[model samples]
Target: MLARMTGALRFSPAEIAGFAILAAVVFLVLPLALDTFRLNLAGKYLTYAFVAVGLVLCWGAGGILSLGQGVFFGLGGYCMAMFLKLEASTPAATRIQSTPGIPDFMDWNQLTALPWWWEPFHSLAFSLVAVVAVPVALAWIIGLAMFRRRVGGVYFAIITQSLAAILTILVIGQQGFTGGVNGITDLRTLLGWDIRTDAAKEILYFVNGALLFACLLLARFILKSKLGRVLVAMRDQEDRVRFSGYDVAQFKMFIFCAGAAFAGVGGAMFTLQVGFMSPTLVGIVPSIEMVIFCAVGGRLSILGAVYGTLLVNWAKTTFSESFPELWLLGLGALFIGVVMAFPNGLAGLYADHVEPRIRALLAWLGVRGAMPAPVAGGAAREMAPARSVAGGRQSGRSLQARGGASPEPGP
Candidate 1:
């Protein structure tokens, strides 16, 4: 049992190397190369990566495509933003406002008392829990309604997109309660710590990186477990799995909720790093862009999501600065090119093209057992062992091991 558990939890050496390389790039290289401003921008990009990683598990692994992830992200950000805004809206701080101790927007909109729903956010603990719980709760409801009924594919995607649009309109319409079009801005501190400083931003960046790794590891564990296999099977053969007596709807709901939880956490971190949560980020456009991030990063690869987010955002910043009018067109073209030319995205490219060369080089260098079997998108493929015929390896081998050429054993 212990050995079985260990094997289940084990990661391939290539995955370990990937993790180390990513850590170095995020924690060491980027900080050394970029100034504080650029580093902060990268930090912001990392927050979106949270959503992309979730998409990998939900869309890539489970075949559940949600285009309304921004709703969860925005909810999480709003939870944190409410806390920060309240802390900044002390009676003394907002003394000049018509209603002291209330958010400026509330006071401007003639709200004399804090809304009952917003009251709970004043407690940091409650706010923290709400950041994740709120989104998951919403996901749970949606999953129950749709997944249980087997409403999925493009129809489900359209529903989620509609949710994003609805949420954006609700937030904008309820200005007094939600801070409206401007969002919950002017956020100053977090539990008495000023979050607007460069030093503070740097600290938050490292914290975000640490949290990202934690999420990645959690995702890895999920994908490596039996549950992960079930998800993949359900993705490829949902009716088969359902007919085999598994609770397909339950599994789908769980993974969807998990994705929402991850997105919520990202939204909270985004609020801290950017010091604001706006409707612009919680709308249809941003939601669609989030999907593009996952696709560009290799939706099947968790780590690739982070790299993709950084790459796309960096390109957006660079191109928009130069050709503001054509940036949208370029972005559309880039997405089209990626979808058409590289359906599996960067991770697929690396696995198909780059990993083999690296393995050959290691083999040439007489490195024995240093390079473990390669994984595609951080998950080990299910390969069959070579069959023995006449006391020798032959016949009945898997497609990956045809012609007596056995694939490398996975960890």
Candidate 2:
């Protein structure tokens, strides 16, 4: 803890304050700088960051490439959307509305009154709880069933994809309760504020930026913890960690649930900004997009996920809507280029290009000396240990026991 804190203390006052100033400008002042349309798109990109952060944990650290983050995102959005819709209908105001207390679709499906299941969501309090609780519960149950059986890799990915597909189907099929394929729409308010107002939208965007920052900090804390090392260990060698007496299933389950919760938060924020939610939001395609976001960002790095989501989503919104024809080809080619060139993700490119320059600059300052050569070599040996092709996960266990080494040199 001291080492980490001390390292943080070394940041130049200028660098630290500049970072704060920049963030304040982007998050606080930028909404005022941009129009509602631009702010809305920026908010969407930030929500993707939330999902990408979760992906970084599951795919990069835990070796679980989940394609069902969209399901969680949709769930959260729908949960909150339901409440907002109900609120707009006015149980939240002077008097409650008539029976059914839901959108018209619920009335059309032969429903007479609000279902007991939806009763809690009428209150904003329950909706907020449901946003986090529901996704985490689903993830916990699914992870328990799959991980304990040692199901993983492509199998796990497929299961998650199926989860997204199935959820979309269910939501669409339930025309009354779920608002059918349209899911939910025409939402005009959130927390008693009219989302239609520019001021409300601006506040929502800032809240989202704050949430993204908080999630990033949370990821940093987790990565610096012993559990994080164990997570990385499990990523490299599941069976070895299991045999070593750790409850591997529990660890995996925890991360899976945490990632799901993050998705939920993102989804909720997304619904508030967009004023809509549909089966399409939670479908297989969107889930895959979430995965692609993290992969394109830099699967192994938290900040990479943020940058990748913003840059790619910005391009998607800017180009796809404008060109209509060549945009998809450009997007497809971008995908191919990223995969073919930077397998580790955009952050990998950043590490490759920028990290070295930063390191060189530090060296030139002579305030921070060069990393000791032997120690530098030992750290690389530590992060990726050698094992014969036949060794399997056993190599990671041996590697962990062998050394306490620093990180590999940037790039």
Candidate 3:
């Protein structure tokens, strides 16, 4: 019944068209007007946009509140940074007797030579894969252990937070591989690509913008699919969804891995654009900010995620530059005000002005039969749910009830 009422404002194509064009305009025009410095700033916001989209899926769609994605983001960033740092070095610089051209901390500690473990990162491709695969595999194992036991909500948040804290401590203590407190620096190039060049900066800017759009498209596709509905089911009624027949743990694992992977992409984009990353980027403060971005954006909504990320980061950058001393106060007041009054987010502002006509267009297109099947969500999940185990806590109808048949099952 609640779903029915909300369906009154069913999604629309006209709205989607308008959004696509506006996004293209922003992507196209911004680089023209902005200086390289400002373009880089836009890149940073785009990275944050990726993070916010993941938060939307894990929080908005799945009902699993994660606070430690920053850790995953950093893992990917630091990993990529290591590779870039390696590539930036000359073969002569890496020689054993080579001037002890150690990382600065090593100079302080009298250490020498890049550690053996750091060597594989010399290959650009390897580093890129490590950045993505490492965090996702870790998230997969962690999600399996936790979600299978049905640990979620606050408990899930706590576990993720603990993971972030542990990672930070480990990185700071290792001193050798991680570069200790000062963190990795002096990274100047990537794969013979001169990062200092305006061309490089522009390319990186395009990478950030393109990835944000891709993630947005992916997020919207997932949300519109039947599997997406199942994920939502698992979010809204974990125990019941299980009893009805779905492998709840597997569904959770997939989204968890996906969210971590998205964070990794964001992290890589961040390191490449910003040219630095440290424990601070992955610490508790950032973990909190990730949640705040999701919350202010609208926990379960993609548009909400994009809006919140761009707006929050813009505010942070804008305020910090203009009034560095008042940055903290400004951020705090702004978040507090938004949470208190417009928790649903600026996406709501967009919807109010434009959604009705969009829905009407979708309905009209439906009548013409020229449109392909509505692909609001993207690629389908491969795993099949054990339907006998799926259902109970929710008042909403399951996909089982909707079609009396499953969409062709995934791998």
Candidate number with greatest TM-score: 1
| Pairs with steric clashes in candidate 1 | none
Give the per-residue lDDT digits (tens) of candidate 2, residues 96-181. 33443456667667777777887788788889999999999999999999999988989999999999999999999978888998
Q: lDDT ranking from best to worst?
A: 1, 2, 3
**Candidate 3 local lDDT, 1-411, one digit each (tens):** 654455423445433654566486457777888888888887877787677788878876777778899988898888888887766556556445333444444545555666787888888888899888988988998998998888988999999999989888988898767877767777788877778678898898887778777887777677666667888777656666777898988888888888888889999888899887788888777877877777676665676676677678888887888999998787778678767865545554344344435546866777553222332211111111211123352224455454434445676
Model 1: weakest 10-residue lDDT segment is: 382-391
Question: Superposing all C-alpha atoms, what RMSD in Å does each candidate have to the true structure?
Answer: 6.9, 7.0, 8.1
Better of 1 and 2 by lDDT: 1
The global C-alpha lDDT for each of the candidates, from Candidate 1 onward, is 0.87, 0.76, 0.72
| Pairs of residues at least 3 apart in sequence or in different chains that clash in candidate 2 | none
Clash count (model 3, backbone only): 22
Off by over 4 Å in 2: 1-33, 91-100, 365-411
What are the per-model numbers of colliding residue pairs? 0, 0, 22
Runs of candidate 1 with Cα error greater than 4 angstroms are 1-6, 374-377, 380-411
Query: TM-scores for all candidates?
Result: 0.91, 0.83, 0.80
lDDT of 3: 0.72
